[model samples]
Target: MADTPQNQAALALQMYLDTSASPLGSALQRAPMMNIGIDEGELATLPLVSEALTGSQRLRATHAQDLALTVDVEPDPARHALVWQMQMAQTGEQPGPRVHNFRPLHIALDGSLAPDLVIHTWRGGAQQSFFPPDAITPERHVLYPRTTAFYQDGTFTIGTHGGRSSDQYMPYMLITTADDSGGLWVALGWSGNWQARFVKPRGTSDLHLTIQIEPCDLRLPSGTTLQGPAMALGLYEGDAAVGYNALRSWLRSHMPALPSSDLSHFNTWTAMDANVDETRLLDAVEQVAGNGLHYFMLDAGWYPSPPNDFYSGVGNWRVDETKFPRGLEVVAERVRQRGMEMGLWFEPERAYHTTELATQHPEWLLRVPGREHALVNFALPDVRAYFRTFIADLVQRLGLRWLKWDFNIDPLPYWQQANDGGLAHLGHINGLWETFDWLRSTFPELTIENCASGGNRLDWALFSRAHVNFANDQYTNPDCIRRILGRMGTFLPTERLNMIYGPFQRREYDDAAWQVLEGSSFGVSEPIDNWTGQFRTSLRHHLALHRATDAYRSGHFYQLTPDTDDLCAWEGWQLHDPETGSGVLALWRSASPEEQVSLHVREIDETRSYRITDLYHQSGSQTVRGQQLIHGLTVGLARDAATLWTYHLVDGEENQ
Candidate 1:
């Protein structure tokens, strides 16, 4: 019989070695990249590692030299859509990059993407099998779109579609090898975010996604990469909390509402508060109402006991009766009473080593016959059914308006531990796909937030229903600019902006705000918790900037410079009146610290004279012709402050 796809991949890895003779053989033997091409046989299979992403899952990350690219490969009868990935090891000491999802990368057939076919038991993990719908809605999140995928019908199509952008950087790693017989195995890889793990199978939420690292891989040129599932960079979205009413109420209440769509504005939720008592829970709700937050969330630890320990009885999804004596009703009621919306927390897939969720539904837990990384498997159809019912019921009972969904652990060994296929990582991620469908279909009104410990699992696909990606930043130093981009920008668009923004401290505004919000909005975990001088200025400035300019809040987006030092980087957003041809311009400077920064603006109508005012800084106006503005503007900034400029078109009649 002809060699099976699995055998072909094994052979490919062997050949890859003879051709490249990479010295990193040991590492390759561990986590190799996969590839496909003319040979079709030269694919690499990743050796099964005992350890899964035990501590924290990674989202997208890019640092000095360390690069990681992940692509998704869907299976086919005749062939497969090859996807691959590259992850740079931590280079710098300063929290390198806490990336959650790798950017979505595109590749061609000439040994591009990864190869295809090599399952732990039956074609990777079953998770690779799930897919989501295309439409966007509250039901469909913006940050965690499960349907995000890439494809190729045939090898010829790869070239026919314009093969090899050889000129660019795939500068990551190569994944393909030759067999002793000279044939190459076709091994392709891809990744995604998950709602629940199928490692050992928890509940009946049959959702899964698989990412095969492969047995061997080649290093491509720098910048070489693949776009995979974006579960890693989860950001928190809208809340109506900052000011209730999803409609124009808040804007009308505040000022002449800017004529712009909600490109940012991810609502707020009570983030990461381990409320073990009813009083604490109520306080958290009041806190959400007290602040101007709209999307109030109750993060991990609200269930019963420690959160990370999902299998324990304490980790049950049910509200701790003791703490939530009145159940979620009070919490939701309080949030609504405060004119704020609310979202509850849950980790259904991860049953704790001591919890009723686990004890009663032990069958749901995934277990690799001989491993310690036991987990739940979402591949089992029965499990998916359970999840659907559980979540749907919660939505109905709690009057839950929002959902703060979480996946706190990395799941590799969990799959192996699940025993079902020993491919639970690949299998359980399926839950992500199913979860997206069921969650949206079941609770169409509820907003979901896909979070894997902040931005760890943040990515593009999750956007299907998750409007926001939680970038916890883990309270990292506020001064690190790279932290912002590395965690949030890899896959998202301008729509996820207002979903960012946060409590800015004057002392750390230079370090935190500048780099932290390069691609996101002004989201704050503790908006009014601590108010001081610098914090006050930073907060006021952020509000002024976000509120005044359409770009940061909602407008045509632009990234003027690469992320680097010495060269001041900038992001410009222009809001033009389609009819009047007038609007505001906002800019963010990330270069060197200076009192004055200058830039040439683009897309301005030179013929029309304009009046520009510093929204946050000047509160005044200066008459400058369009020519000077478009070429860039030279403005003074506080040490590490932001500047908002409003360009009011000259009303010929008024001016005269």
Candidate 2:
């Protein structure tokens, strides 16, 4: 089941047109020319104007109204992944915004394709059930879509739209056969709201997928060029893990490099919340400097005096001299003295009625007929330019090296039927891209972490340019952390996922430490002074273990266990570096009765013997042949315990 074009299915499209033209077929011999009507007419398939195989396994198609698209397919030996891009340019003689129901991309298979396959979609983000700020639980209330769907067999179509904050929910879907033999992975590259569908034609084995821009009423002026997001489809013939790995490979190859930084972050929000000051921050920097930490971040409330909070003063990005009489730069200097980079958190997309931006530039906010809070109209050229210059200047002047960019609220009542035309949310997202691009270019070394009211904004569209993500606001809840980390890791690099470690005053203490071991970048909210000797020593030990197992950053990932709703069950994952034959496995047992579980490791060379080192216990080392390891390795753990083990190929033992 290699991903070569010869093995993977090719697209044979049937186009519906308004003219006396016959239905276009893939057998046209040459690329065909089809005239398309701008109005929503009888179009059974995508109204393709032209198509060309752009590269090996890649296809490009253009439609009327200057809608250009490129579909790029990359075939791994066992899997074929396809990514498509859409761009719209103005067509002469026609002027207003164009509205059309773009058909879904179709994938047809002969009757030989199996009938037992399942279609899956994510809840977009943790806050999907909540529309505006009112319905949202301020901290950690909802957690159903832990970003997964149960594995089942049977042909069906499912999709999800909208996201953490942007337009489209989550932009990816996973479909797998009942036997896990093979399936397809679909992804969209747009940052704003979008729509996608996975449909298995009734009574037929064919699966048809369609992904298109949403809020289709989005207005683009005549002669204006609007770039839509791209959709990617991947076909693989192995298990879901095999398919996910291929998707990850495609992302790594195409997505922008993560912003430059060591990314060992420390945030104030986890510990101090909105209560922050220069003395406490400086103290935190000095204490954590010796713990192998690299970045110190000033979370919300740093920008204003005691009276200001993250909610109201967000739009006014200014320094509150009351908190830092010597200016924010002094804190930055203190951080630099301790050899740590400085980071500041900001919620730039939202503005409350009390802020200066809302008062002075009311027009910059996206206004719905009835809503109170205004979402910044980043799509507006002037607004984007202003924030770009403002944030860039702040970073440069303060010598800041990192930014914890947060979007706390979702833009609801997005548009009014009577006034706005076209997709306003889209424009806001476009502005997001513009601002991100400007920051990247202006400060090449700056690392920007994406946070949308705690893991709401987790999607590929933002990750392509942003460095790290605030997975969720629920760092204290081990179950929540476990769910987020395990599932999000299916697509995102483990290292790019940001998790917090803290005193865990309200919950189980050991859970926080376990969470720290699982995430890519580790953060501590509490002041170092509050850390007991035992806790501090354990933190240092875990940090050292993470450093040793750093190979996990670039290694291939495999989820060894299915996610369960039960907190008592066991779950685990492995990150293995094929080149070095080294990897790390993390296992956790909640309240489950199982005292010991047998884990079947994956992707190791069967000829080599691997030596497993217990990271937590450090009590002993054991060697097992890779073949035996794959069958199963039994590890004993007390109830509600977590442990990490690092495995490396034993030298001179490869032939064994």
Clashes of 1: 199
The clash count for each model shown is 199, 16
For model 2, residues 1-656, the per-residue Cα lDDT tens digits are: 23232211233322211111111112122111111124553222343223234343433343455444333433333334444443455555556435454433444433233444455554444532221211111111111112212343223333233233322345666666656666666666666544554444444444444554445554355665554554555665567677677676666665556555466667777667777777877777776776777788888897653453567677767887787788888889888888888888888888877678888998877665555567787778889878877887889888888887887655534533323444565566667877887788888878888888666665566777788777766666556666666666666677777776564564325742454446557677765556666666766776777777776866678878766556678888888887887888888877689888888898877777888888766776787898877988887778878888899888664332
Output the worst ten-in-a-row residue range by lDDT, candidate 2: 16-25
User: C-alpha displacement of 507 in model 2, angstroms?
Assistant: 9.5
Kindly list the per-residue Cα lDDT of model 1 for residues 380-463, writing each as its tens digit.
667788878777787787677667666644554454333332234433554665676577666667666556545444322344
Superposed on all Cα atoms, model 2 deviates from the true structure by an RMSD in Å of 7.6
lDDT of each: 0.39, 0.61
Q: After superposition, how far is residue 631 of candidate 1 from its true place, in Å?
A: 2.7
